[model samples]
Target: MKTQNLTVKAVSRGLTLALSTMCIAITSACANFSGIHDDRQMSTPEHYTSSQSLPAERGHWPSADWADQFGDSQLSALIAEALGGSPTLEQARARVAAAEAFSETATAKTLPHIDADNALTRTQYSANALVPPPYAGSWQTENRGLLSASFDLDLWGKNREALKASVSQTEAARADAEMVRLTLTEAIARTYNRLALQFVLHDMAEREVRNREAINAIESRRVASGLDTEVQHKLAQTRLSASKSKLVGLDGSIRATRYQLASLMGEGPDRGLSIARPALGMGNDIRLPDNLPADLVSRRPDIVAARWRVVSLAHEVKVAKAEFYPDINLSAAVGLDVLGLGRLLTAASRTASMGAAIHLPIFDAGALRAQLKGRYAEYDGAVARYNQTLLTALGQVATQIAELRTTDVQLNDARDAQNATRQANHLASLQFQTGIANQLTVLDADLNTLAAEASVADLEMRRRDRQIQLAAALGGGFVDASVAHPRNTPAAVAAR
Candidate 1:
C-alpha cells in the first residue's frame, strides 16, 4: 500500500513538471490583438445639464402608481387589465426567460464537468488471428466503463468574462420588460382620455342640433310674417343640416375611440361597447426629479437596458481578447477495461489516466485579430446606443415639460372663453323674456355657448393627456436595483 501511494505521488509530480515546462515554452507564442484601436465613446449626464429648458429646482420622481394621480378609478382599472392580458408584455417576459437561460448556460461552462460512459461488444476470434492460447477460436464479450472529468484552466478569464456578459444581458432584458409595461400603461391612459374628449364633444353636438332647430323655427316665423327673406330662412335650414352632420361625425369618432380603447385592453370592439365615458382629471403640474440628467440614466428602462448592453459587450470584448491567448485544459478518466464480461468489474480490469493539454494557434491567418476587432466594434456600437438612449430620454422629458407648460396657459384661456359665452347666453335669455331680444338671438347665443363649452372640455382632456405623456417620458417610475452599484460602466470597461 505504501509503495502504491508513492507511485501515485510520483506520477502527479511528473505531470506537474511536464505541464509547467510546456506552459513556459509556449506562453510567448500567443497571437496579438492589441494594435487595434477604436474611437467610440459614451456621453455623460453633463451633456444634458447645459440645456436651459429643464427645470432648475428640486422636485419629485413619479411613483409606481403614478396613474392613480389622475384620480379616475376607471382609468386605473383599464391600465391593470391591459398589463395582465397584453400580448406585448407577454412577449417581453418571454425574452427575459431566454436571456436567463443563456446566462445559466454561460455559468455552467465555467465549472468542472463529469460524465459516465460505457460500451460492450461481442466477437468471435479466428484460429489464424493474433490471439494465441487454448481459446484462440472461442467467442468473447468485451466491456468497458468510464467516468471522465474535464476542466478548462481559464487562466485568462475567458469563461469568467462570458458569464458576466450573460448576467448583464439578463439584467438588460429585465429592464426591457419594465419599459414595455410603462409603454402599455401610458397607451391605455391616453386612449381613455380620447374617449372622454369624444364623449364631451358628442354631447355638445347634440346641444348644438337642438339650438339650431329652435333657430329654424324662429326663422320660419319671421319669413311668414314678411319680416325676413326666403334666403335667410333657407340659410337657417342649411345651418341646421350642418349641425346634424357635425353630430354624426362626432358619434362616429366616439365609436372608433372606444374600439381603440378595447384593443389596447387586449379585447374586442364588444368590450368597448361596455366601457363608460372616462372621468379622468388632470393631475398636479409636472415636476422634475430632484436630480435631473445625471439620475435620469437609471430611472428610464430603455437607457438602463442600453447601458447594460454596453456593459455586456464590454465584457465580450475582454472574452474575445482572451481568445487570442492559449487555452489549457485538464482531463482525467477512471474506468474498467476487460476482454470478457466476467472480469469487467474485477481489479485486474481497473485503469486510471490523467493529463493536461495546451492549445496555441501557430498560423490562424489573422482570424483571432479579426474576431477581436469585431468584438471591439460591437462594444463601440453598444456605447453609441447607450448614449443615444440617454440623450433621447432626457430630451423627451424636456419636451413634455415644455408642452405641459403651454397646455396650462391654453387650458386657462379655454375656460375664460367658456365663462364669457355663458354670461352672454344668460343675458340674451333675459332680454328675450323681457321682449327686448328675439328668440333667434337667444338661440344663437345658446349655440355659441355650447361650442365654447366643448372647446374647454377638449382643452381639459388635452392637459390630462399631456400629463400622462410626461409621466411616461419620466420613465414611469422604473427603478433598477443594479444601477445603485454597477460593477462596470461602458467607459471603464472600454479602457481595459
Candidate 2:
C-alpha cells in the first residue's frame, strides 16, 4: 500500500511539472507577440522631395486611366479584353491558389490530428483435453474499435514559424499575380501606342510618295521641252521610285504592328480588328510628377514581392533554429473490445490509453547545424536581393524622369524645325512656278521639308514611348491606400 501511494504521488508530481512547463511556454509566446512588426507603421515614406524644375509637384503617378488619357474608346475596350482573356494572368492566379493551399497545409500542422478505426474477426478453437477449459470453445467472435488523437506541442515554435513562413509565401504569390497584371497592362498600352505611331508614319510616307510623283511629272515636262537635262529627269524619277519603295516598307511595318497589337489583345494574328488613326493635336501635354515619396518602393508589385520573400526567408531561419530544440507530442486513444457485438459499446468492455513523447536531437553528424547554416545563408541572400530590387526600382524611376524631360525638349525642337522647313518649301515652290529658281533648289527644299516632317513624327512617337516608360516606372498609376500594402490588397492602377 505504501508503494502504490508513492507511485500516485510521483504521477501527480509529473503532471504538475508538465502543466507548469506549458504555462511558462504559453506566457513566453504571448510576450513575444508584441514584437511582431505593425505593417502599417512601415507604409509611410521617411522622406518626400521634388527634384526637378517641372511645374507638377513631386507625388505619386497620376491615377488617370491610361487608355482614357489617350481619349480612344476602342483602345480602352481592347485593354479590358486583354486583361480578361490573357492566359498568363490566369496562370498567375492559379499559382496564388496553390500557394494558399500550401499555407493551409502548414497551418494544419499546428493543430491536433484525429482518426477513427474499427475491425472485426472470427476465430475457431479445437476442443482438446490438454487445453484449458476456457480454450475449449468451438468458435469465438471478436470486435474492436478505436478513436485516437495526437498533437505536437509547439515548444520551440517550430510549427508556428513554418506556418508564418507559408503565410508570407502566399502573400508573395499574390504580389506576383499583381505584377503579372501590371505587366500585361503596360504591354497592351505600349502596343497600342506603337500601332498609332505606325499609322502616322504610314500616312507621312504616302504623302511623301504623292509629292515625289508630282515633282517627277514637272521634271519630265522640263526634260521634254529641253529646259532640263536627261540626267536631272532621271534623278527625279529615281527619287519618286525611292519614295514609292519607302511607302511600301511603311505599309509593311504598319501591318506587322497591327498584327502584334492583335496578338497582345489575345486575338489571332490574322484578326481583322482595325485601329483608326489617333487624333494628332495633343502633343507633350502629359505632366509627370517630379517629387516622389520613398514609400514608392512598396507601390511596385515586384518590390513588394521581393520584400515578402525576405520575410518568408526570415521565418524559415526561425524554423531552422527550432530544429535544435526538443520536440513534444501527446497522443491518446479510447476504444472497446468484446466477443459479443452488443457489449462493444458498454463501459465494462471499454479500454483507454494515453501517452506523451519527447524527442531531442543529440547528434546527427551536424546535419541540423548544416541546415541551420544554409537557412541563414538563404536569409542573407534574400536580404541582398530585396535591397538590389529596391535600388533597381529607384533607378528605373530616375531614368524615366530624365528621358521624359529630354524627349520634351527634342519634341519642341522637331516642331520648330518642321515649321521652318514647311515655310521654306512653300517659298521655294512659288519661286519655281515663276521660273525664278531652278528645279534642283525646289527639290532640295522639298527634301528638307519631308525630312523635317518625318523627324517631327518620329519625335512624337518617342514622346509617347517615354510616357509609357514613365507610367511603368511609377508603378502604373496613382498610389492608393492599398498600394501602401501591396501584399494584402490587389488593387489595379490605371497607367495614365
Which candidate gets the maximum TM-score versus the true structure? 1
Q: For candidate 2, lDDT tens digit of each residue in 230-288?
A: 99889988988988898888788778877876777677877624766555333335555
- Tens-place lDDT digits, model 1, residues 1-496: 7998798778866876777577657756756775786767678888656458776566687887898987889888888888999889999999999999999999998999999999988878888989887658988888989999999878779999999999999999999999999999998888888888888888888888998888888889999999999999999999999999999998888888888888888898898888888787778767676667777777899988998898898889889888877787888899999988777878889988887787777668999889988988888788888888888888888888888888889878988998999999999999999999988889889888997888788788888887888888888888776664644766666556
TM-score of 2: 0.82
Candidate 1 TM-score versus the reference: 0.93
Error of 1 at 76 (Å): 1.0
Q: What is the lDDT of candidate 2?
A: 0.71
CA lDDT, candidate 1, residue 326: 70
lDDT of each: 0.85, 0.71
